[model samples]
Target: DVKVTQSSRYLVKRTGEKVFLECVQDMDHENMFWYRQDPGLGLRLIYFSYDVKMKEKGDIPEGYSVSREKKERFSLILESASTNQTSMYLCASSFPLPGLAASSYNEQFFGPGTRLTVL
Candidate 1:
């Protein structure tokens, strides 16, 4: 079975602090992603890595960055944490299904997220 693990389940930090959210997937998947969950906007992708040390900025990458140093591990970094950045952050990994559309590549296995609160 595929498993994804996050370094934290909940985190609290003051504004301007640097925060690191870690994710590790058991499967040797080709893609890994970080997303933030908000009420109306739903899950907004922050960053993704398709291969080790290769990353792509996602929809809302302004305050975020990602690192994929190893195949099974991906890290999300909030360069300067802010109150508005408080949200449930999710990590997911997936393999590309043959013939599946690129957007639908998110048919993935997700980790229990890190809920961050910045004050």
Candidate 2:
């Protein structure tokens, strides 16, 4: 089965500190994404990478960045953690559109996210 594993289940950081959250997938998928899930805001995309070393900024990229150096790994970086940035960060991976089987492309699978709390 396809699997996405995040480096941390929870994290605590001081305000203005740098933070990194890592994710790895073993399925050799073609797409990966990072999103912050807030109580009323739902999941807001932060960044996404379609191929190794190639990335695209999502809707809410301010104060955050990403890296995808290896086909199986993706990372999210918070330049300066702030109390307002505290939220559940999720990582997802999926196959290319018109995926493995033309009609088999399904919903994105989510990782047990990293809940980040900035003090």
Candidate 3:
């Protein structure tokens, strides 16, 4: 089975402090995603990468950044953590299907999740 693991299950930080969240996947998937999940807001993408050394900003990348130097690992960076950033952070990776790609965008298998609290 494919597996994704986060560096932390919970985190606490003060406002303005820098924070880093790491994720690693065992599957040799081509896509990795960083998302913040909030109540009512569902899951909003923060960043994603399809290949090593390449990344794409997602819907909410203003307070975040990401890195993908290796196929199995992805990192999320918060230059200055804030209270608003406190939420459930999830990491996912997927392997795309070639034919009928639209229907097979690779279901995201998420990590256990990191609950970050920035006070």
Off by over 4 Å in 1: 97-103
Report the C-alpha lDDT of model 2 over 22-113, residue by residue, as the tens digit: 99999998789999999878899999888899898989999999999999999999998999999999999987775435423656878999
TM-score for candidate 1, residues paired by index: 0.93
**TM-scores of all candidate predictions against the true structure:** 0.93, 0.91, 0.93
> Which pairs in model 3 have colliding backbones?
none
Error of 3 at 35 (Å): 0.6
For model 2 the local lDDT of residue 38 reads 90
Worst 10 residues of 2 by lDDT: 98-107
With a 3 Å backbone cut-off (N, CA, C), the pairs that clash in candidate 1 are none
| Candidate 1 residue-wise lDDT, 34-118, digit = tens | 9999999999999888889999888999988888989999999999999999999999999866552674645788999999999
Candidate 2's C-alpha runs over 4 A off are 98-105
